[model samples]
Target: MMHNFNSDPFYLTRSHEFDWNGNESAGNGIQHVDSADITSLFSMHNGIKASNASGSLQFGGSLGQFEKWDDPIVADHTSNHNEKLVKLAQNREAARKSRMRKKAYVKELEMSQKRLLQLDQALEKARHQAAKQRHSIGRDDAFDRAHARWLGEHERLMDELRSSLLSGEGDDTTVHLLVDAAISHYGDLHGIKSKGAGSDMFHILSGTWTTPAERLLMWLGGFRSSDLLKVVEKQMQNLSLSEEQLVCIFNLQKSCQQAEDALSQGMEALQHSLTLTLSSSSLARPSSGDVVDYASHMATAMSNVHTIQSFLNQADLLRLHTLQQLQRILSPCQAARALLAINDYKARLRALSSLWLARPKE
Candidate 1:
């Protein structure tokens, strides 16, 4: 029947012979059917029966051809989607790491700010302490200068007396009595006894007095010239300090003392304040604005310290002027010695001032 169908050109039909169990026997002929006839067969068969019979019929191509047509397009689409997913995951991880790095940088900046603030505060405190020490040294130098001037005057007087006695032109008995009284008075005042009781006057006249305070007082009390004493006394009376001037001088002394104490206390307070600022947990993390405020406060405090120092310097100048005026009443040699002493003291003070000024600040 298949040979007859194949021999006919217009219609081709191929049939499969099936056993009674409805299964096709081997080699019972797979064959091509015409499209119209296959359509009619499909119309007669239900969907399940058609699918089962599909293998027996010949189509244009096998099922593998359809899969081959779609495979490259589907594979390209899947490759592109997988690449997109991989790129998206990489970008997400990168973004996360970038955020972590940014957070670390911010933390480092915060720590740096805190460290700088601490350094600034420490520098300010060091400056305050240095200023305080400078003022204290200035006060001490002033006192030393005054005392040196007194000692210089005493040495000058001793020299003058020794010269007069050695010349042997003065009243010998009166000079001897003056020397004895001066020595006794000086010893009593200084709580010191002359080492060589009998030779003390001779030693002083020979310019060999070794005790500084005793030598100074002996000079002070040894001047027995009634004429010179009268002249000095009259001059002193003429230049008698007014009650108001005396009070001012006394008040200046008190104020200087108080300023010294105050400066000491102020330095302590400044240190305490800085300690609190640096050591406090809350203040240790100060912001930019807080740092600015602290700097301003330190500037104000430094200004006040300078003002006090200026006043102290002015007071010292006035005291120096007063000493100069008093020294004028002494003999030329004595006055010159006193001035030299003052100059020496001033030199020392200048050296100290220079040292303080040159000290390195934080």
Candidate 2:
């Protein structure tokens, strides 16, 4: 009575030698099972266990065998995703920094504009006040005395230079001292003019220190340095200058001319700007019923005029440098001659002014 179940997973089969009473052992103790069948049964049992543990076979191999096959692909996808996240973060940070820079730049620009406006207003107010009152802009009695003293010194030095020239081999030391003094003396005039630039802006801007004849030749705020070079050249013609000296003079003249041209252009532009500022109808736009901002307009005009002082300063420096350089190029006697030539030219202008003034008027 052994069971025969071939459909079962265990594949148990009954022994063919068993009797109906299940007493195969009645005659021969027990029926002997085939060793090959036992072996096949145990092999099937082990195969089913492997299939259960690994969730069935796949393409003739266990499921675990293919598990590592997709691991490399998953790892690659994860790495790519991390890199994208890093790039996105970098882009966001860059955008944030750029926005911050733009904001700061705009803020600074606005602040600068505000400060510039304030400065202009103060200047305009100061100029207006100066017109109503007498301010000591370095033009006190002491300055007048100093100016007179400077003129006398100029006369004395010129006389000494004349005496030195009349003597044989003119005093080189006197010539050197004269040039040095001339150069140094400009500082006093420059300082006085600078003081007046802010307090008496119009007077300094005009040829206030010059006679009418001198003013006729005035450029910017004073005489052009190039004109002085011409005088020096004319005076040295009798000296029979060497090629090097002439070339040096010509080069200096060219440089002075170029500088004058540049300053002229700048001054023209500044004049245009000042004209617009001064003549702007915003200060008197009552007809339009719009509120006028007088301070703003005046400030702009004052600012432009203030820049004229800087141009005057540069022109003064050019004249000083021209004289100093010319001194270097000329011999002591030649320099004395140049100095005398300049004085004579000035005297001639004064004579012309005197004759013009004395002319019979209708």
Candidate 3:
């Protein structure tokens, strides 16, 4: 009889000899597996059978279970994410290095400008020293002329004494007379007191005592020596006045200093503003590699504007003040003469205008 093998326990297979396909014979002449019973056994095993399969059936020993799939598309997405992170890190490092380099460049430029200013100051000092030396040389020349004249007069007196004595006409009276006259004449020529205990060469040369020598040199007429002295004193007064002229020059110097101060302050303000702009742009925008070039152009324009404004406002004020001071110090005619010699205000204004026009526009 045909039995239901799907639900029959006799249809179950526990060895490779189980006739899953119902083709094997039992030990007795009765067929052990019915079609319905075998179907029940297959259904009980979830439609899987170990026998009558072409290939060996794998049974959950490190295989034959649903696999956890490794998706290639997901792996590509993770790789791209890591690459972007690395690129961002590299960009950050480059930007930091560029900022450091720009800072170093600006510092170096400031140092160079400071050194140039010091050099200018040193040069000015050297010129001042040279002027003083020149004045000193003029004084020395005047002193040398006076000393030579005194020495020549002394030699002449000695020659006269020797001739008179060799001619047998010199007596104690002559010697005394000659010595008295020599001393008197020396005192008067050099403006020394005849009654002084003694006098050195310098005191005799510079002393204002000419009465005694004038009386002794009566035979030579009242030598115009006093007139020569008056002239010398006048020259010394003129030298002193040169110092006054130099004081007037200080007006110009003060003007220059004020102009430079104004220019420096304006430029410093502009530099600060430019630094702020650069910092803001760096932080607010993505790196586009063109910020540096644009920033440089803007910085140059700002610096020029600051410099021009300083010259227009502060330098013009200083220049006008200096001009007023100069006018007060010099007569109208003298000022015109001097200004004409130097090409005058019109030329100066023209030159300034030309320079301003040549500068780049904002």
Instruction: Please list the C-alpha lDDT of all candidates, in the order they appear.
Output: 0.46, 0.69, 0.47
Q: In candidate 3, how many Å is residue 231 off?
A: 43
Candidates 2 and 3 compared by TM-score, better number: 2
Off by over 4 Å in 3: 1-70, 139-362
Q: What 10-residue stretch in candidate 3 is worst by lDDT?
A: 192-201
Give the per-residue lDDT of model 1 (tens digit) for 132-213.
6534532333333333455565455455555655576646454544444433333332222122222232332222222222
Task: Specify the highest-lDDT model's number.
Answer: 2
Give residue 317's lDDT in candidate 1 (0 to 100). 36
Which residue ranges in model 2 land beyond 4 Å of their true spot? 1-146, 286-292
**Which runs in model 1 stand beyond 4 Å of their true positions?**
1-70, 137-362
**TM-score, every prediction:** 0.23, 0.56, 0.23
Per-residue error (Å), model 1, residue 326? 44
**How do the residues 1-362 of candidate 3 rate in per-residue lDDT, one tens digit apiece?**
98676566565444333354436544443335557766655554552344225333323322233333457998799999999999999999999999999999999999999987866666455445443543463333443345447646755665565555558676656654554444444444333221121222222223222223233332112222222223323333333435565566555555555555656577577657656755665445546777776667567755654454433333334433544454445433333233232222323433343334333459
Worst 10 residues of 1 by lDDT: 59-68
Better of 1 and 3 by lDDT: 3
